[model samples]
Target: MRRPIEFKLRRRTLLAASAASAVAVGFARRGVAQEATAAARPAGPETSTVTLTINGRERELTLDNRVTLLDALREHLHLTGTKKGCDHGQCGACTCTVNGERVNSCLSLAVMHDGDEVQTIEGIGSPDAMDPMQEAFVEYDGFQCGYCTPGQINSAKSVLEEINAGIPSHVTDDLTAEIAVTDAEIRERMSGNICRCGAYSNILAAITQVAEERS
Candidate 1:
């Protein structure tokens, strides 16, 4: 009877220790997660002035250090033409022209482009007077839901411009030779821009038409 009682006491002690260890581990994990969350959070309302050329005009703004170019355009500047699809660089829905080059606005900080030229769809054209690329999109049914239209147009325009500028893409045959505007080339160049509605065929047609007209 004495031996059994001793063993029971030991068992209870072991169980209690295991439970305490588990609790400590859980608390440690939670602490790590909290630290990560805090690290990811943008650090402030501290502001600075930024001047970006949107479309054709230069707009000045005072923005937070953490403010993304996408937020600056949509939330601050009141230019909502640039859609925030994934808000990550993956979707390319926030594609915009920066200094004659295309970039994912969501991936860029507003302060990074203090003196850079930024162009959104709104700056590209308006409802009454649309750019040729915008007109092509309309005529070719390049968009279905239209949520991704602005990004698609911006990316498409950049793809053409890049090709014209002799920039080689993954599909380009020769690095030294001028890049030709082909379906494969367009597809490869615009691969970063995702269209969930799958109007790919129409989009291709529109891009092709623009390439031909410009050539």
Candidate 2:
């Protein structure tokens, strides 16, 4: 009888130990599943659809709400001329004309301007028939790597228009009349666009030539 009692006690202890191990295994699996589910969850909001006129055509695209106008132009529309230097608004590589006004495409969102007209570098001129600014850039050797030329030309064009519209620059002494497009004014207005290759001399020459031609 003592042997039988000892045997039964050992069997019960073994069963208890097995059950505890099984429970531990189940908990471990549950923890792993929870971790996987958390990781698989999406980040930020889902994409949405937006339509806008680009260049001279209307385009529709479904993009993430967080997508910027620059990304939409370059990634979706395949207008890669708008360079992405400094995704923030600091660099003017993503400069484009929105409704006749120059704006940093990187700073704006595609959804913000639903129906606005966007003019990218591609829209400015074609390879065969170049815009005056494009021709001027080539004639004056305004670019080194040609990375910032698009933004530079776009900004310069807008600056000239602004000067014609009687807008004053930071260096303007009097805001009562149309500001003159002097070399200093050009430098001050085009300060946002940076050419890493130190092509300021050539760029200024190109812009000055264009301005003089237009004047």
CA lDDT, every model vs. true structure: 0.92, 0.91
Estimate, for each residue in 151-212, the C-alpha lDDT of model 1 and write its tens digit: 99999999998999898987899999888899999999999999999999999999999999
Itemize residue pairs with steric clashes in candidate 2. none
Maximum-lDDT candidate: 1
Please count the clashing residue pairs in each candidate, in the order shown. 0, 0
Q: What is the C-alpha RMSD, rounded to one decimal, of candidate 1?
A: 9.4
Best by TM-score: 2
Q: In terms of TM-score, how similar is model 1 to the real structure?
A: 0.78
TM-score for all models, in order of appearance: 0.78, 0.84
Error of 2 at 124 (Å): 0.7
